[model samples]
Target chain A: MKDMIMSYSDLSSSIREPWHMLLFILLSSWTLLLCVAPPATWAESDKITIYSYSSETSINNFKLLKMEFDSYLSRFGPYELQPVKKREDFERYTKGRKDCLLLISSWHFGNIGQTYSLKPALVGLRNGKKYQKRILTGRGASANVEDAKTARIASAASDLHTKEALSEIFKGKDVADRADILTVPKDIDALMSVSLGMCQYALTTEGSLEDLKQVNPFLHRSIKVVAEGRKSLLLILAFPESSGKVRENMMKLVKIVQHMPLDPDGRKKIKMFGLDGWQPFDSSDKLTKGD
Target chain B: MKHLKLTWLFCFFLIVSSAFAANRMPKVLLINSDASVSKYGEVQEAFKEDIPHPVVGVNLGDEKWDMPSVENLLYDEYPDITYCIGSKAYHIASKYIGEKDIVFSSVLNWLRLPLTRKTYGVSNELHAEMQIMLFRYIFPDVRKVTMLYSKRYTQELFKNAKDKARNMGVEIAGEAVFKGRNTISAFDRLPADTDAFWLISDPEIISDKKGLSNILKRCEKRNLPFFSYHEAFVKLGAVLILSVDNPTIGRQAAGIAKRVLSGNKPAKNVEPPAGSHIILNMRKVKAYHLKYNENALGSVNSIVE
Candidate 1:
């Protein structure tokens, strides 16, 4: 009985087939190759997702912007220009996601940073300027702040900055009651409302007004600025709190922003974002309470 | 043989007389309100290109000359035609240059100016229908537009805008703000549904800074966009403007001069300037948050940021 068991064990031995030796050698060679491979190629699969809030931005425009940014960052390697356009898409993409990047308005940055504690990577700079002022424009006579109590006002809906500024301007008065306020989703609508006499006045930013002038030259002569409001940074970029490879990549991207591309193609890409170049975001550049 | 000799002498005589006739070219007098205003140079250059006859230019407001002296000069020169530019020059030349063909230009509100059979003018104001058409082109979504005008200055324009606006499916609501009446409050009472404020270049309505400020404030309170006749008003927050192009107007005047020189009966009524330009302020577009119509924006002459 012992001799029969020994013969069976030998028949089933691992070296019974030559193919088993070849499989062992292949496995060892693969393990060795993985161990010796460069870190960059190893980390090629890791991706950083970018998201922009859909306020006035359209999906196609966002996609174009993504392409521009992706092309600019191609030299950096291992980065994807995956831009999330909608608010829901952003939430869904950002939920429990690691190594993510966010492009947010200064207003949203302040609001979201309180909970997530985001670290800014770089902020957009326009014509070498960083701050903008909110203002009230109306017909020449009734556009002033003093007349706002009884005036019909146009404002952007869901815009916290404009709301806050209006609150401060009409602090003592019952703004909700005294002023007949109409809220629209975009700044251009509010301005058109004022221009068309649908409303008496509008609240907007100086930079926004300048941008509007580029599209509607008639508004330059038609809208009279009645009052000025608080100043603030327009846009900012942030990285998630847990810093790792993303932070390193973000640092490199920030360096690129600091020294903007001089080529015409790079310039055209940057101009779409209303910026001539990028600037480092320091403590001084951080948003203040009123700003 | 004697008859042949007589015929040759007569032929020589006819040749010499024809040469003498060629030397006596018609004279044209060019009178400008302010010749130093560089735009007049453009007018002069354009006029010369079209009118080949000899021209004598007179600066109406020159310190070296007065209306009486200018009158004396006109009588002395007895020019075949007089070209008057600007309101001052037009008025002076009309009074001083007697009966000679007069072609007037660079004059604002030429419609109100006195017209004679011998005097034809190119007015700064375009036809009301043209302005209304442009407004419709720029703001297709707008249904109603409001204008504040003094009857003395803008009665015809107001009528024309109203008639044309109706045909174009747009409505024009105008308030007649008479001279010396406190017109500031008139802006406050603008139609609530007004899609835009049309500002006419009436001195009675727009000359007062305080009144203009009040009107602008009211527009702000109501969110009504402003439109105007002057490009300068764009800086004051007007969204759109249509103004006469001086050089183009000058060329048109020269064309009229050619017609008059060819013995065509000079028109007894003032005609709108042949050319004008549209200025758009896109900043106001952002301030009001209007939807950008790329197709409409493409038609504008100049866009201001």
Candidate 2:
């Protein structure tokens, strides 16, 4: 107790001057502000946040994709890649964040891009094709879509999107609700389900069928194309419509994406997302309008 | 005109012969112990994907066939290779198709299965070398790890893991508990220098949920990161998990089956699980203040936040 009283007396005695009191108050307030303020406000202001969600990549592999993307983007500035697993969460994160960029599936962008005022900046290319076709493959030799009614169809598409895509392919049959849909992890799994007699048909992409051909030719030859849907655009990198500083910052980030393929490390990173490279988004691409 | 007609006839014959040859390809009978189980179904689908020839699948879970009936069915189909998924399938198939090539997967402690020169298997558990190497990859500073095991369940596994750890400059110490009730106490008695706790697939050590919870709680109290062999343990506060990838195991089994069908013996009779599904519980990692290599996140199959 005596030591505490002496220490208090010493501190009080040292700050007896009017100038000392003003300096002490200023310093204490500054320290309090530093301790209480949210770190994001100050630390993240200069960091470029990129929110990504893709139905094509598995949830687990998305984490790896984020790591690779962040490593490549770090060369330019403070960049962070955040993986959003659900569509609702992606919408919540990117809806009002004008300063951030969204790397998402074109199907999803078509649904919400207009509502959010997002302008397509770049489109992903795979094997030199900007769009791909989804095919319904089966064992039968029929090109009619009505055969899918009441049939078990295996697909790798997200549950909601599968219904939409099926509605488009079947046109007016309402097969999405009538058909028994089995969800798998990858396109190959869906194709294999048809080959192994687990399902009546498989709703997969043309690229996946090509992959199966290379993997097992006999199984590939047995599968017949039941129907093919219209072309669907690949992944799109977009930014919100904004003005002034935010727009300037987004443009700079867009340039980085535009030149990413030229760099070896950046090319490797983009390849993790199953993309060959990036090209300027075509505003006239009808697929982006809707199904 | 005569030459053209002869060429057309020859072309027609070539097409017909190729179609006939395709029909004569060897068949494989895939006997699943239970197709109702999701993992079993996943394995079946993946196996069917890579196997080049036609596959005929029969679900033992869906059928009730007697010995004579099974024998009759085999005689009817007469598969060149028999691929069994679980222990039950392997047992029944081996009993009927004696001395033929059999490839099995998803069998626990596959060392117990009857083996022959023609038997090939994909072990259900990942190899000790792989687990330890992953541990080192994630936590380079963690030099010493401790695990509790029962003599009957994990004696050999512990010794093999310890040897593999030694080769990688990591020390793995094993504590034995004869009863499931003593699992927590055994964990409590772990050496103070233990950097981490590894939970292997030991029946006695992980027999009850309460015992497992107590061990994990003790680990938390001591600030020891828990490494487990199942994804379910992540919710129970496991910092890292290494589990077998069922689909990959199926593909691996298919590869072996293809090789054996082509008249080539596999380089090894029993191969360790090739693929591992790694799960990292970021919440537990942060709560425990564990140090892990950020670069290693690429290899993680799942993350629990």
Candidate 3:
């Protein structure tokens, strides 16, 4: 019993042997590696990620949109659809990822497309139109742009983009900075806010207003368009300009999106983005270059 | 010929009376627990929008009203159906107008309410099935979750949630803490394999802000993701929050009210809240280094960076 347990000095002496010391160092290093390494599942892969950012689609629909889109894009290759909620996050994600593609609103593209070197490949067509207009709507007969200064403006656009769009519509009025903006999930919500008396004005697309007119004529009748913005392009599927493998992968994505409307499953997925189909982007087409 | 004409007039009178009864809109009385609470106001506003009937609203928290005054008002209005916003309003309405059909929302642990055949509700919290499914959707790898709850308040909830979670290929482990006991110690007894902590709305377990903060701190120390039932916890480091949309709950209650008023029986007496508002705390997610479904971002109503 006395010899069964080793003393601290004896244990230290036992580890002094050359092989014992080597084994201890090796074990320590292995433990350290295990501590510092990321889990095997989290390791980076070569799958091409497509970042989607659309102000038109409500955040609640992003998951369904991604699932449907992913199911369709799976046939093409190793493609992943990541829906980004914020415009800044979308831009940050696609900033340096040449192996990625972006499905973004043209309003967003016009703002940062040149900076990111994203060449628009296909333009989304909703109701067979390539361009859509933004309208500032208010309750009753209050349609003046100056009314927005004192009124709470409801918009589906991000606060930053809402200000920019409003600045363009208001033109020379510093109302954009002072106007109280309420960011809702969808254009319908923005319009409904005005109808519900939650907000005095709503910044929504002309298409959305028409949609409301069809669905809820009672509410639509209460809202009047105060101002309108120049025709802006719809959604754009753009690829970062790059050479070699990255460019080849991006071109494949372009082909997939262009052919999305042909397949039944593809059409279902494309419609989630609030579009009827996709059209080739012609450089000659006149569209609003967003500020 | 005179007898034939008299018979025809009697038949016409019967048809007209029945038609008038069918066309008569049921009177709806809205009882809000507190007019000062913005959420209650939102619910009332949304209810007004969808009801298609004129609604008389009363604030239970008003200084001018007492139990007897409220009772008198109920007797006077004699609403065909009562809509209650919170638990206090529900209790008062059920106590006074128990005979009439009642529709309630924003009440916590509605299963504890004295529900009857005439009672319908939109649950204040998301159902265990929907919540567990959401957890699976957002965190596919989180197979096991642990919760600390007071048996009195959450035992049935835990049992139901356990059953639903089991069906979804997830395990829910619970530790029953006595009322007024220190619930923080239960965290140490959690299983080693727990992938996340589920914060249920148990008043006995989380009695105050300090207790909630301590639990959250403990979760952070253990590097476990905490999923809460309220959005306020998101800013305090809850990784995910699933809450009922108040306005939608109002609309849902109105829907049920419409059914009851139109003499149509609802498919179910009590239904889960139809609209769920999800909030994701990105800071906590990153801090915990949690694995989350990036595609599930769209389901999130708000993200706290």
Candidate 4:
């Protein structure tokens, strides 16, 4: 306590000892404070704070964010990385704070940019329904691969987004051009179509398809992620770079992101939540399509 | 005084037993989830005969019973090291293995093992999946593979295998309801154009290769290729990508033994089970008149063809 007071003490104190000596003093004092103080000290405090942006919060995004927050705290000091569940809290954190990083979906990202000063420095691959014409099918369906025969391929989209993505998967040869695939409007409808024998297939998000049986245990008996063709940047980590200090947490966050490979749930959640990675920048950088 | 002299003589016997006790060795308690210890039977026999210690084997099936209850009594009756043999047994042993290092064996879900506990076990080792995926890769035309399970324990290897297969662009055809009903009628109608039948870890359906062999005969009659996760299932009839390699499981158990014997704190020392070795047999492949990639032959532990 004396040394810490001496190190950062009032103007008249000593300057001879190493700061590390002061660190130990502060450490012991803080440990003593923690032990002596009320339990609330462990909760939100005046110390470092972390704010993560969540959109349409799900278990996947929540977990990965928590893991990253823990990793950040372990590296830096023990700071509170508070996860705000709704966009309203997110708005509050960013407006009053310069240290917060915001993550939003692609649909909301454009709105965030138009209404707020946040910039997108990272890109998340959007992996759902990459094709409008592509229809996911079941195991025991009889269909030829010719384009004329492909309309039987059923998905939610009446258009050909699924078809285009499937074509891209086959390198623009157009699997639909070569085969007949029917399209649908929604994933659930497509899943039901195939499961109920209405159609042979459905176009759905990988995460959604993977968890279908989780919601309906009997669903997995007849459904699964058959072919992975859709991929896009659906999530971006945006922070108001107008302020110089905005990059402070974002930089550490970027550094933290690079090393999160060991956390599969984090990676999977990042994918499921439609976000790519954290990008640190000054507000001057443009958050645009060129990215 | 006479009784005291007799006690002293008995004390001398105890000293000899404690000192030169080659025959009366330190007892090690091994518990398993099933009476079919054959899965880990060989290793248990090796531990009993090879170790300078005595190993007592006990079995408790997959129901809530007094395993740890018996274990507590055993620890009191005889001071012994407990090597839990299966996943459930390990959990039962966890209740009592405080401050004692524990070795785990023949368990599939290593992730479920308490990371804080000193645990290590055999992993399913992605061998079966890799082999089957490779088979799908070599035979890109194969769109669907069928997996049959007893109504009981359908959760077996379906999810893991299903994900890997689907990701590899192969379709999975699954049918269940094997719990207590012995209706093989599910296979009465095999879907045509089904390329292969992948056997998974359903002991109720296929206890051994021969049991799977009868199923393979049915599959073969339909001109369908057969593959299995269990190695012996391949030897029986299903041309397999892997048979559960118990020896690799033994080595994994030994690895845990090394950790336990070395006195690493059990709570902090539990690690994932080492992966299993895929043993592909070709005689079964030849019987089915199918040509697997030559690469699969290289990975086969025993190939009859």
- For model 3, residues A86-152, the per-residue Cα lDDT tens digits are 6777877789778888888887887788889888889988778889998899999846778876666
Local error of candidate 1 at residue A76 (angstroms)? 19
Native contact recovery (fnat) for each candidate is 0.00, 0.04, 0.04, 0.00
Best by lDDT: 3
lDDT of 4 at A67: 52
Clashes of 2: 0
lDDT of 2 by residue, A150-227 (tens): 566777676677777788778754657655665555565566556545457888888778766544455567789988
lDDT of 1 by residue, B1-305 (tens): 99999999999999999999778777888988887886676666667755668789888768877867887888899888888887788777777664678888877667666677788767777667657656765666767899888879887778887876676678888878877275876666667887888888888897778888888888888888888888778988998897655655565566567667766643434556434456778799778876544334323546666
User: Which lDDT tens digits does candidate 4 get at residues A21-107?
Assistant: 687678889999989865543223223444555332221124434554565454443344566555677666667455555656543
Ranking by lDDT: 3, 2, 1, 4
**Per-candidate iRMSD:** 16.9, 11.2, 12.0, 19.8
For candidate 1, the TM-score is 0.49
Residue-pair clashes per prediction, in order, are 69, 0, 0, 54
The second chain of candidate 2 has a TM-score of: 0.85
Point out where model 1 deviates above 4 Å.
Answer: A1-291, B1-24, B66-69, B111-114, B180-182, B266-268, B296-299
The residue-level lDDT of candidate 2 at A159 comes to: 63
Instruction: Write the number of the candidate with greater TM-score, choosing between 1 and 2.
Output: 2
Docking class of 1: incorrect
